[model samples]
Target: MTSDIALSVKDLKTYFYTNNRCNKAINGVSFDIRRGKTLCIVGESGCGKSVTASTIMQLLPTLSRIEAGSITYHAERGDIRIDQLARNGAEIRKIRGAEIAMIFQDPMTALNPVYTIGFQIEESLKYHTDLSLKEIKKKAIDLLRDMGIPMPEKRVDEYPHQFSGGMRQRAMIAMAMSCNPKILIADEPTTALDVTIQAQIFKLMDKLKAEHDTAIMLITHDMGVVAELADEVAVMYMGNIVEAGSVDDVLRSPKHPYTRALLDSIPVLGQGKKQAIKAIKGATPDPYERPNGCSFAPRCDFATKECDVMPDEEYISKSHRIMCANYKAVS
Candidate 1:
């Protein structure tokens, strides 16, 4: 791995087994998250974005297992393969909230309803640092203040239900940043917020990235968010990255059919009301019965007979790659 790369996930395959059936939640996904940069993983629901994040965090459930590949965290101490670590082991536990942190999609469910917001943030500090109780409390207040929550001193003692949707999300971010983690995984952090609040959240994230030099893996289905916040972007479909490149490359010169479909679906700001949105036809394939060839072949408008055989990844440039058999013709 390069020095700039904070984490490298290679050919990661995570599967869930239940009732004699296998659901491939993540299939051969690979990406490198560079320090102080944002890598946005954009795709529709059930495209395995959250599963990829969970796999990296070693937080998969009992029935789910990593069947192949590696997740290498490029730590200051050494390169650690996160996929090989025991789920609840000491080493991973230490790394989970300190070296790496996550802001889950929904704060209402993720946060403990009974505990004060400050208590939750302090819990991470207690495990990761040797700060005294008083110090921890002060730090928690400071974090809440940093998140733009008004009157942190009072709000710290409040429970999750006491805060609004945006404030709760900010509190989750505050808790996640308590330990100054190197890599931050935010799975649709702004999904539940209003437009104004969403803008504030993105601005705050940008500020945090600049201040902490944290590498961020942001998973979302919003291409608008990708265009705004992503330094690099990966278009995932059916558990695989169909295209990946710098934001400009992928957004401006998208090669894969799915990527184009996604871009076309986005409503442009100045486009008149009569401008028709092109929604991608067909739903994602069933994980238990994935197609033998290209997973997207069933939905692609440009799919050919050759699509019945899986296409090898074709490099458009050192920074851009696509997994389409007819990328040349399509481009």
Candidate 2:
């Protein structure tokens, strides 16, 4: 809605239709990513975090469709409603991997094994720009170098398998950043890496953001990662954003029960006594069989009869909001 907002997703509902049953993967998801800031989406597995990223990138599979809502991208040219762009059409093509890029969860799966890493990076540049093959190749190697790959001139010519996991991840980042996209969507990019490598990846992303002023939509379940990079955090549950605010507001003064539960579950360093780790009770509900009312009401400790109907989104502050009936009582 504002010039500073790079991307805004409003009430997005992405569903999978199979056997006449609809699996609501991302129901009523909304958030804003501002230019040069990182917005982290955090939740447990199957909470629709990754699906939300895929939807924003217009990368949803055949069975999936955006059933409702809008994804608006604020470009230098003008404001564009991405949801209105035809799937995989020329308009969407101009945005995906160019103006808006995504780094997927697994580089091995996302990268083409048969193609050299340089070719892959160049492919994006070639598609989006009118650069010559030689220019694209030179830019590709430069991107890899920027990503901190050793001797990127040599490594760029190597295939995905030749590089280590960390290297491959870096290559993926290089490819995503090749076009200097306005928005970068990274979906659990550090999921398979060790703590050290994960830290390195985040640091690289932070450096990229600083240099490029890129708005980042980071989808991760790790609270630690969220702590490291997020300016704002959105805690999603059962396809709904139950809590959202500045990182400190959401992490330190979380009002929603779900947010509190999530924070309490994170294992702390030097946590004094030998107490068992805290974990949220109950599993995520089945997507196809989501219950009426609050999807988390079944597991919420403070659920009331009022929870049988989804509560109105209550603002704790201008930037802090929660969709819980008992937030006032709990906080």
Candidate 3:
């Protein structure tokens, strides 16, 4: 663990056991999240983007278990192997909200409908900090204000149903930021909002990153969101990262066929209406019976017989790496 890196996940393998079948939701995934930087995990749904985040947070469901790998959190106090910690233990409980916080995709379900917004925001502060009730309430209001909510003093007393969709998302962000976490994992924070709200959320995230220097692990499928917010980008397929690099390098010069296919699927701003959008050819492989080789090979235009075996990671540059046997051909 280096001083700059906030967290490092190496060879992570999270699987779900159901009906005597092992579904490898996240297999051999690895990445580093640096302080004050945004790492976007982008791919189609079921690509294990959310699973990776959940694994780090130790919030996986009962049926799923971390089969292998290490999640190392570089704390100011010391380096801690999160994977080794007992899930729901006192140590992980302290670190979950205080050192690292998460903003979930659906605020409605994540938030307690019965509780007042202020109370919910204050919950973490009460548990994580030694702050007095008055101070906690004040901080809750301040966080809401920081999240661009109007009349925070009044809104704090309101319930989740009283707030609009965007407001609920902002409240979620406020709650996540209340503890001043070193790492903030936002799982599609703006997925349910309109474009305007999405832009506002992104702006709010940018402001928070600038002010707090928080390491953000953003899981999203939208390339536009990745383009707007990511400092580093990882393209995942079938629970594995097929390509990763600086956002500029990954987006502009993608090496893996899957990465290129994802990029090509994005609609261009001024392209003629007659121009057809490109879509990836095949569905993601069945989780219970994943391909023995490259997971994306079935859908990859550049795939060949050699792709029948999993390809080792190859570095295109000091910062860019791709896991594709046919990368050179595509390049």
On lDDT, the candidate that comes out on top is 1
Worst 10 residues of 1 by lDDT: 279-288
Which tens-of-lDDT digit does each residue in 255-282 have in candidate 3?
Answer: 8888888877778788878667789997
User: After superposing candidate 2, which stretches have Cα over 4 Å from the reference?
Assistant: 274-276
Model 1 per-residue lDDT at 140: 97
What is the lDDT, from 0 to 100, of the residue 108 in candidate 2?
92
- Note the Cα lDDT for every prediction shown: 0.94, 0.91, 0.93
Ranking by TM-score: 1, 3, 2
* Each prediction's TM-score versus the true structure: 0.98, 0.97, 0.98
Q: lDDT of model 1 at residue 100?
A: 94
Q: Judging by lDDT, tell me the better candidate of 1 and 3.
A: 1
Question: What range of 10 consecutive residues in model 2 has the weakest lDDT sum?
Answer: 268-277
Determine which window of 10 residues in candidate 3 has minimal summed lDDT: 268-277
